[model samples]
Target: MANENCEILFDYLRSILYDSTPTQIDVHSLDEDFQKLGMGLQFLDHAINELKQCSTALAKGNLSEFNPSRDNFLCDNLKNIHANLEHLTWQAKQVAKGDYSQHVSYMGDFSNSFNQMTEQLKEREEHLKSEAELEKKHAETVNKYNQLLLELIRQSNDDVLITNIDQSTILYSSHNKVRVEQENEILYYFYKNINNPCEWNMKDKDNRYYHIVTINMEWQDKPSFAHFIHDITQEKKEWDRLHQQAHIDALTQVGNRYYFQDEMQQFLNCKTTATLCYCDLDHLKYVNDNYGHDKGDTYICDFVEILKSNIREDDIIARLGGDEFCILFINGSIDSINQKMEFINEEFSKQVVDYPQSFSYGTIYINGNEDTSLLNILQIADQRMYALKRKRKMTT
Candidate 1:
């Protein structure tokens, strides 16, 4: 019976060590020694079960239930594994928070990989920071240039306006000299023709003229317009003064020969009803030779004053040359033009005492014929005037 108990105790111990099957032990029927052996085997089985639970907790990353006894080899190994896992968890959290300096030392190949990852992360972070700084500097430079351009526009005399396509929103304006009525019209026109650039004239509230240039452009990613206005009122006045000097006779303050020809061509083009009267001073050369050139000048002025008094405000008289003159009597009949010429001759005779200030004149009435050129009309009048002058000389 002792042998049987001993064999059962030995089988139970072997099964605990090497097999997964449960062992049956008859401890109540055994002697003292066998009973003590059975109690030890039961304790070892319980310890093995506890060890399995600890191993399962570790596999699942749960360390709460893992308590290692002192000086125990297997438990000590588990404790070390748990400690390493906790430290690694802390390092991973630091790395997640942008601390790329976190490193591992004890995990051999894993430590090398972790350190390499941190180094690459730090390099990428630095590159991104550098890019951010460069972008900031570029933005500041663009802002500075914009400010300078704005200052230049403000200081310049040229009026500038920047607006959206509708012009309901004004983006920028250099000055506020544009009239409200004209401004509205300009915006309406620009909005309708946003693609075309143009130049034109406008008048402000003070009746001053402005030369305006408009261009199509983009502002803030939207279709827009730019208007540049230059005040040209003074320029226009100066141009008018120059034009008058060019077209007017200096001494007589009447139309010069150039003005006479220009008006003749315009009248012919429009088929106007008019009479061309060519006249020559009867004794201008005699007066110039006998009483000096200044007296001849006075004789000419006296003739012009008599001509102006008889003619209407619309009639144009011009000095053709030194001793010749021409008249364009607008809408005048042949009889009315003859009467005017006779009256002028009679009045000038009384004004000049030294030399007879009579003028011989020839008239050609325009009949609105398309074939009649300005040259032909002037030539006919000039020939008749010379014929009259020759007749007068023969009689004297």
Candidate 2:
């Protein structure tokens, strides 16, 4: 059985060494040396058995002579086997210790197999190491982008909101929250879904009386994030006040000469059909004399209200100066102006029953044949007003 095993190991060695085989030899044949493995394990067993037999022989005072050639052969084979196995054991330790780059140099030409395995392992190890380094660098790059994105969001002054399109409310800015009214349900909904840089007009729930201008914009590169809101109530009020002041007489709170001038210029420039009715108080100083300057001022204020009530909203009525007033009847014919004047004259006549208020006025139309400028035409109307006042005084 030992002989068969030894022959098997020798065949493996021979196949690698020469890549051929001796098919003619019988493994159990006696001429082919009957040897076990050349490692000292078998040699030790044989040596122990021999020593015992020799001891017993010697005890009987008889012994077999030892052969010098056999002893030399056994020791040489054992030394070769022990040396080769110890070298193989050292190569295995290098491989198992993660030194896949390690090569097992042939101790006596038997290490070629181990060398091939180590070379392949070394190639795989190099690839794995490179892959690991790339992954580490990629992870670091992603972390940096995340940090920059967070920092940008925290630093923005523009109201930014984050929300899902489907969700009723995801997140809103504190700036927006402050402007939200008690009854505002849509504000929350709008904040979530609003696309940025868009204009929207909104009303707060508590303050539906005022309009709030809202601006919305996209907040991030992601679709999940959107922005909203503007509170323009105060701005609108200020705008209206400024607009009023532009065309109003500050003291009397009526339309001023500047407004009348602008409207006349617009009419003339646009070639609009219109008539002008110019009126002047006949004796404003008489009231200042009979009563007081306070009564005179009261009389002027009362007359302004009457003028405002009598004229159509489209008509431009203005105090040209202290005691003179101008009216531009938009698209009115001479007949229309006459009818309106007659009505105002009837009302003014009634004021004489209790109040000392009387006025004289004249009207002019932009007839196709008239080649006069609006300013010159106003001058002509002024002359006509005074002429009528003089005629009325003479008749009274």
Candidate 3:
């Protein structure tokens, strides 16, 4: 009978090992030795079943479903996996909440992938933070400059006007109350006088001069135009007075040395074809010594008139000093200028028959390609003029 019970116990233990439902054992009916073995088999089967249940829950990602007892030694390895998974779950939650310090060490390949993911996330977040800081600083700088521009616009004497071209209305005006009623007139003036962005001059009905500056701009999210106007009547008058004093000679009412230099520089910069002639009146000192100083003045004026009549309106004639003159013939050929110079000499001799007044002249053809300064050009022309005067003296 003990042998038969022993066979039953072995069969039942084998069934438990293979995870099959084992036949029940009656410990009371067996002998003492057999009963002790049957009881131990029952405990082994129970622990194995507990391990299976816990491990199954873990495989299904259900960590909270099972808690094995301390005596369940078969489930020790499973419990370790469970504890690590639970800690890893908490770490994942921390990572989601922007904490990047969490690490997993013992989960094999899964640990490596998870750590790499966290490191990339941390780097991305730090880069985004830096960009956000830079954007904030840029916004602050733009706003500060905008405020300064507004202050300058407010404090300026210029009449700041912003007009909505599409709406045909004034959007903003520095002199709002004063110029509000003149909206139609202002728009008319802008449409008629202003075609591009430029500084221009206009006169009001009262003959008051105003300097107008216009630019294309945007206002209130719409295409617009900004017109800055200031009364420049006094400014223009002052400038003209100063210009006349600086550039015009008092004696002959023509361009002085300063004006001649400026004009020569402009012509050279433009690189245009032109001709320069330097001339000096003959017997001017003799005329001043014999005839009165008034006659000598009359002689200079008559020569100026004759030169002015012979040249085109665009040509420049300037009295360099007493009895000396320089002329810029715009787009003049050497042949045409030489013929004109001969004619001028003949006319002067006929006009001043009493004192035999004539002139000596030297000419240079400028193709506008000379890499020379105004002073150098003037020196060359002066030497040529002296050479001609010496030749004339020898013949006389």
Candidate 2 pairs with clashing backbones: 196-216, 196-217, 196-218, 197-216, 197-217, 214-230
Per-residue C-alpha lDDT of model 1 across residues 1-396, encoded as one tens digit per residue: 789888888888888777765576767778887798888787776566566767788899887777655544546667778898889889988988899989899888989999999899889989999999998897788779878977877777777777876645678777645655666655665565543568877655566777878888776568877888787889988987998888888888888888888888887888768888999888888999999999989888888888888898999999988978998888669988888788778777777386777999999888875569878988999999998888988998
lDDT of 2 by residue, 275-394 (tens): 888888756788888777777777777767777888888888788878888888876687878787778766766775334677888888875444568779799889888888899899
Stretches > 4 Å off in candidate 3: 1-158, 165-168, 174-209, 212-226, 352-354
| lDDT by residue for model 3 (102-162), tens | 9999899999999999999999999999999998998788789867976777787767777
Give candidate 2's TM-score.
0.45
**Per model, how many backbone clashes are there?**
0, 6, 0
Question: What are the Cα lDDT values of the candidates?
Answer: 0.80, 0.63, 0.83
RMSD of 1: 12.3
**Alpha-carbon TM-score of each model against the true structure:** 0.56, 0.45, 0.53
Best by lDDT: 3
| Positional deviation of residue 154's Cα in model 2 after best superposition, in angstroms | 9.2
Pick by TM-score: 1 or 2, better one: 1
What TM-score does structure 1 among the candidates reach?
A: 0.56
Better of 1 and 3 by TM-score: 1
Of 2 and 3, which scores higher on TM-score? 3
